[model samples]
Target: MRATLMYSAGDVRVENVPDPVIKHPTDALVRITASCVCGSDLWPYASMKPEDGPARMGHEFIGIVEDTGSEVTTVKRGDLVVAPFAISDNTCEFCREGLHTSCAHAQANFWDGEAEEGGQAEAVRVPLADGTLVKLPVAPDSALIPSLLTLSDVFGTGYHAAVAGGVNERTRVTVIGDGAVGLLGVLSAKRLGAEQIILMGRHQARTDLGREFGATEVVSARGDEGIAQVRELTGGHGTHVVLECVGNMPAYQQATGIVRPGGVISRVGVPQYEEAPIGFGSLFRHNIRLAGGPAPVRAYIEELMPDILNGTIEPGKVFDTTTNLDGVPAGYQDMADRKSLKVLVKN
Candidate 1:
């Protein structure tokens, strides 16, 4: 088997690795059919120190069940399934409350102390199979593969931001960032009936897709200028809600700056900073609320599956580049260089 490994920043390679096998009663061995590079994966690919040895890369994947441990019963051989980025025992208290990302036994599939668990490979060992894997009603058509794959992470994450921001029929929303997640955030807001959607992005191609995804306005400005653009569009009152999908300090600042006094800022971008100011003067003075974290993708998969299966939403359009397992490194480079919105790897 071959898998992707990051030896250091700007160095991603697909090399032969050991195949996976069921190691726990709750585990399942899946033969990956499709996988992709995530923006979060780029964080490490860009700045990881040389001393940090190669680490397995990738989390979003869809596949066919090859084998299952004795305790796995929800899925069987030949069933097509998707694995959320985080593996969780869905029976835990947090999972029961619809927060699978915080499950008591939660573990990132890509960091299971072994390289064989990565999604960007020939196969992976999925722990908590009964709880972490969502079985498709039937084997998906090739055209539906990318869309189903997004449900494993980005789409669910975007949906999380929208739900947390309280987007509704009367709400006016602004989504920061036009990455795959940001574009999906626009889509989620539209599906939830947001009255207005403003997307803050500089790329013409992505901003165009943002419009197709339901962004009523695209603000190409940055820094204070961007803030002014959003405010001007909102009648100087700022938006009723803000979705922060970039996870950078500047993007966070923009989110807090353009939200109305009583509005909420829902963030789902993988935070790159260690600390941020959220004191009284920054948030309490305006009565603004902040919410969001790693999306409980497993919790939302079932809810979003129908729309994806029926073709009502095409979040898969985010995958602007496609490649084979061997081309993953180039795929990463294309995304890191802003030449592509997202990359999908067909194994």
Candidate 2:
């Protein structure tokens, strides 16, 4: 089997690796049909120290079950399924409460020291198979694969942000960032019935997609100027909710500054900073509520699958580039350089 490994910053390689075998009763072995590079993958690609050694990469995939452990009854061999980025035991209290990301026995695919299960590979070992894997009604067509794959991570993540931000028919929402997750945030806001969706993004291509995804307005300005534009659009009141999809200090500041008093800032971006200003003068003075974390993708998969299957949503538009497993490094570079929105790897 061949898999992607990050030796250090700017160094991603697809190399031969050991094939996966089920190691737990709750596990399933999947032959990956499709996978992709995530925006979060770029964080390590840019800053990982040279001495850190290589690490497995990728966490979004849709595949066919090759085999399953004794305890995995929900799916069988030849079943098509989507694996969420995080592995979780659906029986846990948190999972029962719809917070699978915080499940007591949860573990992230690649980040949990499991090299055999990284999505950017020929196959993967999915633990908690009955809970973590969602079976598609039928094997998807090549055209539907990318959309189904997004349910494993990006789309679910953006949906989580919108849900946390309390997007509803009466709310005015502003989404920050225009990456795959951010653009999906626009779609999620629309699905959740937000009255107005304001997207803050600089890229013309992405903002254009944001509009297609239901962004009522696009603000290309940055820093204070961006804040002014959003404020002006909202009649000096700011928006009722802010979805922060870019995990950066400046984006966080923009989110905090443009949300109206009593509004919520739901952030799904992997935070790059150790601390942020959430004190009385920053978020408290305005009575703003901060929410969000790694998305409970498994929890939302079943809920969102119907929309994807029924064509009510088309979040896969984010995947602008497609490549084979060997082309993953270039896919990573394309996304890191902002030359592509997202890359789909067809194995």
Candidate 3:
């Protein structure tokens, strides 16, 4: 089997690796059909990541179940399924409460070790199979492949951010960033009935997709200028809700600055640092609600799947490029350099 491995900063390689085998009674082995490089993957690929050994990269995928552990029963061999990036046992207390991303067992599974194998490979071993895998209605059309694959992460995550930010019939939402997740955030806001959608972007192509996804306005500003424009658009009140899709420090502050006093700022970006300063003073004074983190993808997938199937949400539009497993490095470069919105990898 071949997999994407991260050796160090700016060092990503496609190399042969051992095939995965089920190691837990609740685990299943999947033959990845389609996988994509996530914005999160770039964090480690473009900077220092701590690990004693080579780490399998990627975590967003749609695949066929090759085999399942003894306890697995919801899915059988040959079923096509979408696996959420976070592994969870749906029956746990947290999972039952719709907080699968914070499931005790799932979070505990990561705290003791170097983390599990990633999805950017030919095949992967997925734990919590019954809870994590959501079987699609049928083998999707080739045209639907990219969209279906997005349910594993970005689309689902973007939807979570919109929901957390409280998009509704009268809300004006601003999405910061033009990446895959940000583009999907625009779609999410539209679907949830936001009255106005503004996407802050620098690229024409990405802004165009923001329109396709229902952005009513596009601001071609960066840093303070962008934040000021977003504020101006909202009649000096700023946005009712703001979606922060970029994980870095600058984007994080911009997200906070561009929302109304009582607005909600939802961050889907994975912050690169262990300690990030939240502007608690402004938050406390303005009564703004700050929310978001790794999207609870498992809890939201069931509701979101129907929208994707019916074409109500065209999240696939975010996949501006597609390539094979061997072209993993180019996939990273294109995204890192903003040449592509997102890349879909075929196994």
Candidate 4:
């Protein structure tokens, strides 16, 4: 089988690799049908050094069950399933409480934790099979596959940002970034009934899609200017919630600057920095709340799939490009170079 690996900065390869087999009682072998490149993958694409060569790539995937371990019962061979980016035993205390990302099971982990397996390949070995893979009623060739695939990460992540920020009918929202997650965050906020949605991004194509998703306005400025634009839209009060989807220092600062004194800043973007302002002047004094982390998408998959099935929202539109395993290396480059919002891989 062929799989994607990042050899170093700007170097991604799809090379032949050994096939995966069920290795644990709770494991299942899935033959991947669809997968995609995530914006977070760009962090490593730009800075990964030679020493980190050959890291297995990809996490979000929808596949057909080829085999299952003796203990796996929720799915069977031929079942179409979507695997969340993180591996978890859904019965764990944290998982039961809707925090599947913090599953306490001894074998729980992210796709990268298993060095040999990656979703951007012919197949994958999914751990905690029963808890990690959700069966989809749609067929493998369903038109909804791309939309259904988003349930694995981006869509669920955007939904988490809205839910954690406590978006409601009366809340005003500012979604930072125009990548897949940010665009979907706009969709999620609209779904949650936010009346006013402001999307902060310079990309006209993506922001247009954001408008289709539910953004009432688009702010392309940065720093103080961008902050001023958002404030002006909300009567100089800023929005009730800030969905920081860029995961960069500037995006974080922008969230702080445009969030109302009593509002919340939800960060679904994976933070690139360790130290940030949480002191009186930044968050404490204003009584602003901070929320969001690795979205336990496994917990939200079931709750969010119905809308996709009903065609109420088209989050998969974020995937502006498509390729197969052979083109994944170039797909990574396209995304890193901002030539693609997201790339879908079909195998």
Candidate 4 per-residue lDDT over residues 74-173, each given as its tens digit? 9999999999999999999999999999999998898866788889999999989999999999999999999999999999999999999999999999
Give the poorly placed runs of model 1, Cα more than 4 Å off.
106-116
Candidate 2 runs further than 4 Å off: 106-113
In model 4, residue pairs whose N, Cα or C atoms come closer than 3 Å (at least 3 residues apart or on different chains), thus clashing, are none
- Kindly provide the TM-score of model 1 when superposed on the true structure, using C-alpha atoms: 0.97
Off by over 4 Å in 3: 49-53, 106-116, 273-281
Root-mean-square deviation of candidate 2: 1.3
Candidate lDDT values, in order:
0.89, 0.90, 0.84, 0.95
Clashing pairs in 1: none
Query: Deviation in angstroms for 122 in model 2?
Result: 0.1
TM-score of each: 0.97, 0.97, 0.94, 0.99
Models ranked on TM-score:
4, 2, 1, 3
Please identify model 4 stretches exceeding 4 Å from their true place.
none
lDDT of 3: 0.84
Which candidate, 1 or 4, would have the higher TM-score against the true structure? 4
* Candidate 2: tens digits of C-alpha lDDT, residues 1-347: 99999999999999998889888888899999999999999998999887885888889988899999998999999999998888887878988999988788745333335655589999988988988888888664556788899998999999999998899999999999999999999999999999799999999999999999999999999889999999999999899999999999999999988999999999999998989999997799989999999999888888898898888888999999999999999999999999999999998
Residue 275 alpha-carbon offset, candidate 1, angstroms: 1.7
Count: clashes, candidate 3: 0
**RMSD to native, candidate 3:** 2.1
